[model samples]
Target: MALSKFLGLFLIHIALLSSSCFAADPFVFYDFEVSYITASPLGVPQQVIAINNKFPGPTINSTTNNNVVINVRNKLDESLLLHWSGIQQRRSSWQDGLPGTNCPIPPKWNWTYQFQVKDQIGSFFYFPSLHFQRAAGGFGGFIINNRDIIPIPFGSPDGDITILIGDWYTRNHTALRKALDAGKDLGMPDGVLINGKGPYQYNDTLVPDGIDYETIDVHPGKTYRLRVHNVGISTSLNFRIQSHNLLLAETEGSYTVQQNYTSLDIHVGQSYSFLLTTDQNASSDYYIVASARFVNESQWKRVTGVAILRYSNSKGKAAGPLPDPPQDEYDKTFSMNQARSIRWNVSASGARPNPQGSFRYGSINVTEIFVLKNKPPVTIDGKRRTTLSGISFVNPATPIRLADQFKVKGVYKLDFPSRPLTGPPKMETSVINGTFRGFMEVILQNNDTKVQTYHLSGYAFFVVGMDYGEWSENSRGTYNKWDGIARSTTQVYPGAWTAILISLDNVGVWNLRTENLDSWYLGQETYIRVVNPEVTNKTELPMPDNVLYCGALSKRQKYAKKSRFYVNGYLRKMAVKTNNG
Candidate 1:
C-alpha cells in the first residue's frame, strides 16, 4: 500500500507542476523608505519629501504579468498613502492608494503593496495620493515592459529616457493643504521643473544661489524614446524640443497611431511617449521648452521652463532663442485637435500575442450610460469649493468596501446620482454604485471655464467621441467606433465634453477623481463601487494582512477574514516528491 501511494503521489505531483501558476511569472521586490529631505528643487531650499533620500523616488520597471511587491515605510509626521497613477489594480483595488479605498499608512508604520502588473505596458507614474503631499515632491516613474514573447509595435530605439515635467510651487504641502481647506485658490506655481530641477533661467544669475538645469546628453545619429509625464498638481503644459519633430508613439499604456507634431499639450495626470532621433546640428545644443497653457500670463509668475538637449559634438552654448509654441497660449481649438489626434494602434500587440487582448470595445453592448458634469467653483460654507453636478464629495468615515463587507452601518451613502443635478449643493459621499461586468458609456461634461481632467482607478476607458456644447444622443454618431485610444485618464475641455466607454469587469471600490490635487482635496472626486453578484473571495481577494484598522474597524474585536496566500492539496504532493527525489 505504501509503495502504491508513493507512485500515485509522484505522478500527481508531475501533473500539478506542469499546471501550476508559478511556472511563468517572476517576482520583483522593492523597499521604499519615505522621509523628508531639505533641498532645493527650484531656486530656494526647503523641506521636500524624498524616497530613499532621492528627490524623485526610484523607478519601478517590470514586464507584463510580473508580480511587483513594494514595502512603503512612512516616516512623515502625519498619515500618507502612495497611489499608482494609471495602473489598473485588477482584482486588487485594496492595493490602490486612494484615501477611502484603503486606510492611510500612519506615521512610523509600514505596509506592503503586492499586486501583479497584469496586461499593461508603456509609461505611468506613482505619487502621494493624500494631503497634497504630491506638491512637496515624492513621485516616480513606472514602466511596464512587454513580455519576451510579445512583439513591440515599433523598431528598437538606441536608448530610453524618462522626462518628468511639472509646475513647481515654493510653498510646502502643509501650506497648500491649509489654503485649500480655507477655500482659497492655489493661484499659480512659481516655476516649472524638468526631472526635479528648476527652470533653466535659474541655473545662474545669483551668486551662491544658482540652481542646476536638467540637460540630456546624447550622441548624434542615435534614436531615443522619450517618455514624458505631466506630474503637476494643476496645470496643462505644452512640451516641445526646439529643432525636432516629436513622433508620438504611445500614451498612457496603449500604443498610439504614430503621428508627428511640433508640440503636444499634456494635462495633469496624463503621460505620453515620443520617439526622436538626434538629427540636429551636432555642434550646438537645442532648447527644450515646457510652458503653462490657458492661464492668465500677467497674473502667473512663471509661464515657461527650459531644459537643454546637448549633443556629443557640441562646442559652445545653445544656438538660438527658445522655440515658439505651435499655437497661441489661449487657443482652445489647438488643444482639442491635439487630444483628438491620439488613436489606438489596432494592429500592435500588447501584453500577449494579441492587440490589447483583441478587445473590440465598439461591438460590445452598452448596459448603462451616465452624464456627469463639473460645475463652476462655488462658495460652500464661505469656502471656495468645486462640485460635480450639484454635489460636493465628502469622504465617508470608513472605506466603502470595508463598510459593505463587514455590514457596518452608516459608514457611507450609496445613492449617488448617475446624472447631473439641478439643485442645491450637498456635501456627502461620491459613491457611484456599479454592477459587475457592466458595460458603461460615461460623458464627462465640463461646464466650468477652466479645463478639467478626470481619472478612473481600475480600467482604461476608450475615448470614443468628444465635442463642444451639450452631449446629445446624436453625438454618438460622431464616435470613433473603430480605433479610439484606451487610457485610464482623460481630459475634458471647458464647455465641452469627453465621451468614454468602460467595461466594469474588475470588482471593488475604486476612485474616480480629478488629477488636480487642489480640486481633489476640495471635494471634486467620487468613489466607484463595483459590486459582484458573489461576495466570495473568488471575485475579489480577501482582506489583506497587516491592514491597520480605522473608523469602525478599529472598534471591532475581530478583524475581517484574512487572505489565504497559498494553494493547498496538490501543492503538498509536489513538495513531497521534490523532497524525496
Candidate 2:
C-alpha cells in the first residue's frame, strides 16, 4: 500500500511539471495569444492580448546587442503593429513600426520582427501597436540587458522590483477609435492603472466585484527598482512606495543626479525609474501606492490598484502607514520649471520639400475656411496685403520656418499670467494683422554678465521683436513688473516654430543660427533693443532672467480672431555654464 501511494504522488508531480511555466530561453522563437481575460471582479473577461495570460506578456532578458526574432500573432479581429518608441534603431528604419513607415499586420496575421537588442545595459519596454489596441488592452512588457550584473541597492530575496505604470479604459478600443477617427473630442481617461491592475481589484475587498486582490509582497532589507511609464493619453499619476523613500535612478532611460523622494510624478508620454531600498531585518508587508494627480470635477474619482511587498519575519517590521502624497507634487510650476527648457512650434502650413525629405504638415489633415485674400502663395505676406480670416489647415507635420530676414536669440519665458489661462483674447483681429506685419513683441533680456551662446533646442524660428501693446495680469492697474517682460512692441512671425534662444551676458545681441540646416542668409538679421529688468539688480544662477515671451500673436498687442496660426511647441532644454548655452 505504501509503495502504491508513493508511485501515485510521483505521477502527480510529473503532471504538474509538464504544465508549469518555464522561463523562455534566448533566441528562441515565441508565439503569444492576445485576447480578453474574464476577470472575477466584473465577471467579464477583459480583452487583453497575453503571453500565457500575462498582461505584461513576458520579461525578456538577453545579452548585450543580442538579436531576437519575435513572431507576433494577432489573435484578435483588429489589425496589430508593434512599435519600439524608446529603442533607437541602428540601421533598419523600416522596423520602426510607424503606420505609414511600413505596413501594419492585419488581424489573425503573423509578422516576424528582427532587431538587435541594444547593449546600453538598462531597463526598457516593449508593447503592442495595434489599430487602437495599445490604448485599449493589447500589450505590455519590459526588456532588460542582463549584463551579468544588476543595478544598485540590491539584496538577496525580493531584492529587485519593477512596476509598470499604465492606464486602461473599459470601453472597447475599436469603439473609442471610431469616435476619435470621426473627429469627436474625446476627453480624459476614466481610470489610471498600474501594471494592468487597479487598487479596487488588487487590494480593496469592500468592492464585491474585486478580482485577484492580492497585496504586493516585499521583504525588508531589500532594494527594488520601480520602472514607470505613462502609456495612457489621458490620466497623469503620482506613485510612491508606501512609507519608503525612493531614489530616482533614471529619467527617460538616462541616469540623472540621484535624488530621493517618497513619491514620483509621472506625466503623459513620460517614463521614470526609481531605486528603493527597504530596511533590512524588518517586518515585511509593503504597499506600492498610486493616486491620480488631480481629482476630476465629477464625484467618485478612480483609484489606481495597489500591490503588497511581503518580506520574511527576519527581514524587518512593517513600515508605518503610507504618508499622504504631496499636494503640489503634480504642479506645473515644479515639473515645468525644473527642467532645461527645449522649445519648438507647431504649424498649420503646407508641406515643402527640403534637402532631406518633405517638411511635414500637421499631424493629420483637417480643413477649415480662411479669409486671406492678400496673402501670397509662398510667404506670410503678399505685397503687404492684410488678412481677415485665413485657411484652417491641419496636419501633424506642417513645416514652420524661420523668417527670411531675422534671427531669434532664444526662448526665455512663457507667461500665461494668473488670469485667462484658457480662451482667446479680445482685439483678436488686430493682433492677427499686427503679428503678420511683424508687429508682435518678443522680449529677451540677458541677466548674466558673462557671455554665453544660448541655443534654442527645437524648431527653427524667425527673429522679430516689435512694440504692439501692454499686457497686464490685472485690469485694475498697470504694474512695472510686466514692463520688460510684457512688451508693447514685438515682431510678428508665423507660429509653426515656437522656441528661441539668447546670449547670456549680451544685453541685446540677437544671434541667427539654424540647427539641422546648413545654410545662412545675409538678410536674416533683426535689430531689437533689450530692456533691463527692474525687479532685481543682481545677476546670478537661476535668478529670473526677466525675459517674457508671447507667440502666435498676429499683433504684439494681444490675442485676436485673426491670430490663426497654431502654437504647439513647449520648452524642453536650457544649458547654463556652457560656451554654447
Candidate 3:
C-alpha cells in the first residue's frame, strides 16, 4: 500500500482504539464559537476570535506524534487557515498556512489538515496564519508537549500556568488594517491587557462596573512553570512579580546557561519559561507584574497583567507584600550604563493616494527618525537620510535617484520609531531652495510624486564619509576604511557624526558614532519593512552594538522649527535579530 493510504488507515485504527479506552458515557465534545470580543473598558469593540466564546480557545491534549484530529469550522465571511508556528513537518508544507504557499481555505469551507507530529517538548501557540483576516482575531490555542526531553524535576506537576500577553484595539481591528492599508499611522494600544483583561477598577462612587479585571492564582510550597508569550502587534516587555522572584530557565524555546532568578525582559516574537518555588511557610498572597518599556509619547506604558500567588493551608502561611517590590533589574537608573546602546527611532511616510501608488509596488514614500545622536537616519529611497535643522537629508539624492532609476537596486523602506518624535512645528520649507532652516530636507516621492519627511530630537551630526565621496589614499594600493566612515583615506579623525545614512546593502560595512543624546530616550525598534524578499545567501553588515553614537564633535546646530533632530534608515532585517550572525 502507498504511504499516504497506510497513514490514513493507521490514524483511523488509532482513533478507534482511543475511543474504546473511554467509559460507555457519551464523549465530552468541547465546542468553541470563534468571534471578536473586547476586554478594553473604553466601550470600544475589540474583535477577538475565540473558541467557545473564550478569547483563548480551550487546550487540546494527546501524546506526542499521536494522530490528533481537530475539526475547525470557519464562521467568518473571509477564508481562514491555521499555522503551527515552529512545528516542522516533512513534505507537509501544504499545511504551512503561509499565504501564496497554497490557496487558503475559503470562508465557511472545512479544510482538514493532517500531519505527523514532530516538535520540541514544550509549550507552543497556534494562530490563524499570517493572513490579515485570521490574524486580526481568529483561531488561537496552546500546544502542550507530554513527551519530555528531560523529566520534570518534580515529576508531572498538578497544574500548569500559561500567560499569553496580546493586544486588542477595542474600536475595530479594521482600524489597524485601514492604517496599514492607507499608509496612515497606528499608535500603541490605549490599555494593556493580560489574559484578555485590563487593570484599574472604579467603585460605585467613581463609576460602578467601570472596570472588571481577572488575576491568576498560584499556590505556595508548590513549584509552578509559567509559559509567557508576548503577542502584541510589536513590542518587547519587561516583567516582574510585585513581591516575589522567579527562576527563569528558558528563552525563545532554548534553555539558559543557568536558572536566572530575577525580573527579566522579553521582546516580541519571543517566549520565556520560568520555574517558581513559593515561600512555603509564609501566608499566601503575591502579585505577578508585567510592564511595557516603550520610551516615546506615541508608545504606551502599560501594566500588562497581575496574578495572585496563593498557597494552601497544608503548606503554611504566606507573607504580605514581600518588602516593596525589589528594584527591577532593567530599571533605567541603574541599567543605563550596563546595557548596550542601540540606535532606534519611530518614523512614517507617504505616497500618492492613487491606486497605482501602492506600497507593494515600491511607489510609496517613507521617512524614519531616531532620538539618539550619531545614529544614522532611517533608510528610504535606497539609503539613509540624517537631519540636523528639522528633517534634513544626508546624501538623499543618491538613494532617491537610485531607487527611481534602478529596479534591482531598490532599498528596503523601514520605520523604527518606538514612539512618535513629536513637538511644536516651527519651521517651514523654502520654495526657492527646497530647504528648511538653511538645511536641505531631501524629500523622496513615489511614482505619483507624494513626498515624506522625518525628524528626531536632541541629536546633531557632521558628515563622516561616503563610498561615492572623494577620499584620500593610504599610499599603499589598498583603501584605508572598511566601508564608509572617514571622508578620506588620509583624514580619519573619528569623522564627525553626519546626518547621512550609509546604505548597508552595498557598503559591505560602516559605522555611525554619536555624542550627546536626549536623557529621556531609550532603545527604539519596530517590525517594519517596505519590501518582501526571499531569503538568500549571507551578507555582512555593521551590527547594532558596534554602531556606537557617542563621540566629540566641534559644531552644533539647533532646529528653529521647535522640531527634534532625527536619524533615518530602512529598518533592515538585520536590526530585528538580537544575533544577526
TM-score of each: 0.90, 0.51, 0.50
Best-matching candidate per TM-score:
1
Model 2 bad stretches (over 4 Å): 1-30, 40-44, 146-158, 182-188, 200-209, 280-284, 294-300, 314-322, 329-331, 337-581
Residue-level lDDT of model 2, residues 1-581, one tens digit each, is 49996567556433322222122333323345555554422233555555546765665544545554455556766656666544433233334453322345556654555444443333455556445566654445444444445443232224444566654556656666665545443455545566666553332332335444334455556666766666554444667765678776544333444567767656443456667676744445566666655444234244454555566553543344444665653453442222221111112111111102212221212121111111111122221111112211111110011110022222221121212213322111111111110212222222212111111111112122211122222311321111111101111212111122112221221222111000001011112222234322221111111111123221332342122111000000000111133
- The residue-by-residue lDDT of candidate 3 on 1-581, one tens digit each, is 69996677556534542432222322212223445554443334556676556766665443345433344455665656665543332223334443312234445543334433332234445566433443354534344354444343233454567776655455455555555444333455555455655543322322225454545665556767777765444434556664456665443223333344456554343355677766544444455555554334223434344434555543433334322222543543332111111111111111111112121212222233332212233333432333222222121212221222234232322222222235421111101111111221111111111111111111111112222112233211221122111110010111211122211121110111111111001111111111113222122111111011111110111221111111101111112221234
**1 or 3, greater by TM-score:** 1
The worst-scoring run of ten residues by lDDT in candidate 2 lies at 567-576
RMSD of each: 6.2, 21.3, 19.6
Instruction: Assess candidate 3 and give its lDDT.
Output: 0.35
Tell how far residue 427 is off in model 2, in angstroms.
28
Q: Which lDDT value does model 2 have at 177?
A: 65
* Local distance difference test, each candidate: 0.80, 0.37, 0.35
Which lDDT tens digits does candidate 1 get at residues 61-82?
8788876767777899988889
Task: Give me candidate 2's TM-score against the actual structure.
Answer: 0.51
Alpha-carbon lDDT of model 2: 0.37
